[model samples]
Target: MAQDRALLRVEREEVLGYLLLDSATVKGDSVRYEGRNANSHNDVDAIRGIVRSQVLAQRMERDGIDPKRVAAFARFPLEMHTQRIDDKGRDRGVQLGLIFLGYAVALLLYMMIVIYGQAIMRSVLEEKTTRVAEVVVSSVNTDILLAGKILGVGLVAITQVLSWVVLSIAAMKYGAQYIFGEQVQAAAVATAAGSPGAGGSPGLGLLAVGLPPVPLWATVALFLCFVLGFIFYASLFAAVGAMVNSQEDVQQAATPVMLLLVSSVIFMGPIMANPGSAMARTMSMLPTSAPIIMPLRITLVPVPWIEVVGALAGVAAACAASIWLSGRIYRVGLLMYGKKPSLGELARWIKYAR
Candidate 1:
């Protein structure tokens, strides 16, 4: 009965017996066993099973019988070990930070494109509405006038963007410590070290959480994409402005372009989930969607250098083509303004402008 008892305390590779007999003497009924396991908790069952088998063999030997014949021989003993569940390469904080950065870049680009694009539209409309375009047309070529408007507004957008970036970086470096407090900062560091489930919630007040470092190359790529994207869409906005006679007609003219822009943003989630998917890759290559999708993909996956260069080339070509086509519409539409022209008349204007 004593040898059959399985539960025993393990100390320094020795098994201590829990049962005491009426004879006031201790017997070595429990068996000692060694196991190859990293975690002591996982070795508990293995140790107990192995020790029980050994104790039975010892009892058989003590009873003047062959222990090997009487004892159970396992062809394959069951072993259990805990495998590491977390991927060391997958840093959640860094991943989240990269995603947030990409989202911020995409958002800022969208806002700037829409804001400055509309500004160009309104500027063109104001000049045409006041008959200033007529006087200005004498001195400026229509292509050059349109190009100048895009360039001027584009420069202002660039300035505002740079100022915001500088301020944001400065705030992250200098102001975060003062705002978040030392305790929250410590908690942030502790959480990032992989004990997130062990304790209290860090909450949204952890301002000192470390963000993944933004690669310099990504910044350069983002800037180039923003410029090219702005020019491409701004050309269309200018064309829309020329087509419409008044602000009331602007919404109707601008809806298609705005919808296209909005759709690119809407596809952001799918792009992030499967950056290597065909749909994401195709969208990243397109000039209209590339600006938003490519940046988001960059933060999450490795985009080939050739793809980046190819997308840029595609966007540049599209921008040039847009400027040419829009310039034609803008030239003819700016002067004739009693009512908005139909699609047939706009097509005629394009041929005549050529």
Candidate 2:
């Protein structure tokens, strides 16, 4: 048994299924083996080649032919690529670069909302706890102060996002040069320009050479979506912060907003897999989710101008409402420092502001 293991070069644990082993056996010129199921195409093909060798040897020996008299060669190599289904019943190729580009953009918006909104919330909490609000509000209108804070922090967030965009572009353009050099660049461009038969797309060929997948317009839309989404959510965060006196209270106050942000991220998987699906299209129009889903749809599939315009209008309206309501709550809440106010109390504060 030990000798068999030595010959197989497979550990005892592998036989027990604790680990996987690629193995074969030879007996009386007959070969038997289980092919290794590896992730790589070449490895799988090689295993299939090994399986075919036994039949080839049997035919040769039956004919009383020497192995030296027979040879096998491939006329040409087989290449594999994926294609996209187009509008006119034609299959193009999926552009992985654009898919991931959209994913990155959507993810960035999610992070900015969750992270910077928390920052805004924390800033508001600090100013109130420290009594800094008294001195600051003495001169400045509370609404203006709230707007200024949201805008200032939002500008910082936008700057960081833009930096990431520039860095990503630089990495794709220059990193390819650094890694593959001029020779690889020429080959990739050539492959992208060529057709991969009638059934497959050449997009993957370009992706293999590190070419950018998304168009310029998608990037622009990604930025625009993030900007509008940030303002809409940040205003809510400021209100949540104002309603609470401490960080612990902020969590309880901000639960609904947090869930909304998280739901946007959760919806990303389905949207990316089927951007043209009815559900994805519907979510892309919702103001709460549009910031994340719309960009994903725009990046992965073709979206109509009407849906885009309607979504923008919806977000603008939501933003306006959040700012107006949050500003009133923030003004009243900043001065009330005892026990956290109830929802009814918050409503009264908004009414008082009006």
Candidate 3:
């Protein structure tokens, strides 16, 4: 009976924010109602605007006045899209593809780090809890063990990602027209209004608007970013697993790392709106967020070679630092038991451990 109150955590579930009220019309031209959705104010406001327009047109028609002229004057929506030019003075849908390509790649990197990082933590914790590490260490060096766990998992992850990338490339190259259909074709034409006569190419519509030439350099940079950034975060996760005494303590230990990861995604909209801003550049340069942010900048515009090298270098430095620190904690913590160590103890491990 004491076990009946156990709590079970579930994954692949999340709550979405929503606000809705039953609207009522008390009287003509005097109806009042209020509702808001914190997650999507634009959609809610668009609904309100559509309703208001309908009401205004109906009331004006009843008063022997045509609202068409006023509606035309109001100009329901001013349709427009951005104009993106590459360093090569090219805009044949490359920049448009770059927009989504950058966003998708960054998001994938974020998810990979979080997901695989937790997997490493869980693996470390399981071994430590079951006394497997004690026996394993008798035959193997701790540094080698740590490196093996990281590289093994990282290799599998990179392989899976490469498979997905190949499939996506094939899909975009061949089956894109059927997948996107007529709406995307119309949208491609609409977006072409900014550049004029660009969408007139026969049989290329959405493909021309969606995918771009992914250069070899960008591909190499992306691979390096994924490997280095993953190792950097994965080491920290392995340390957290070693530091904690139980599953209950794991959340608290990993919270700071999770927050660091999540913060990088929050500024994406603002960064895309102004890719060349100082905030974007700073994030791109910082080792903590460079994996995701730097890829975003690379895809958004023509970033300088120096900035790219600096960002990659920063990630490499971070990877080395985290690996070193985690190794120190891991070697001692795996053998120590009974309770979690304090911050001072972790510092001492780094400073004094052989």
Residues 101-193, candidate 3: write the lDDT tens digits: 888899999989999989999999999999999999999999999999999999988988889888987876667668656645665775465
Please tell me which predicted candidate would have the highest TM-score against the true structure: 3
lDDT of 3 at 138: 98
Per-candidate Cα RMSD to the true structure, in Å, reads 16.0, 14.5, 15.7
Query: Each candidate's lDDT (Cα)?
Result: 0.70, 0.69, 0.72
* Model 3 residue pairs with clashes: none
lDDT of 2 at 347: 87
The TM-score of predicted model 3 comes to 0.73
- Candidate 3 achieves a global lDDT of 0.72
Tens-place lDDT per residue, model 2, 1-354, is 644443243222232111212222222222222211111234335544654555456556766676455663212232223223222221133355556667877898899888999899999999999999989999999989998998999999989988987886777667756765655455565555533232233433443445345546656666668888999999999999888988788899999999888998888886676676688888998999999899878766556678888888888888889889999999999888988999899989999984
lDDT tens digits, residue span 40-119, model 1: 23244555565446555555666657546563432223322111111122223333455567778888998999999999
Which residue pairs does candidate 2 place in steric collision?
84-92, 84-93
Compute each candidate's TM-score over C-alphas: 0.71, 0.70, 0.73
Between candidates 2 and 3, the one scoring higher on lDDT is 3
Top model by lDDT, which number? 3
In candidate 2, stretches whose alpha carbon ends up further than 4 angstroms from where it belongs are 1-94, 180-220
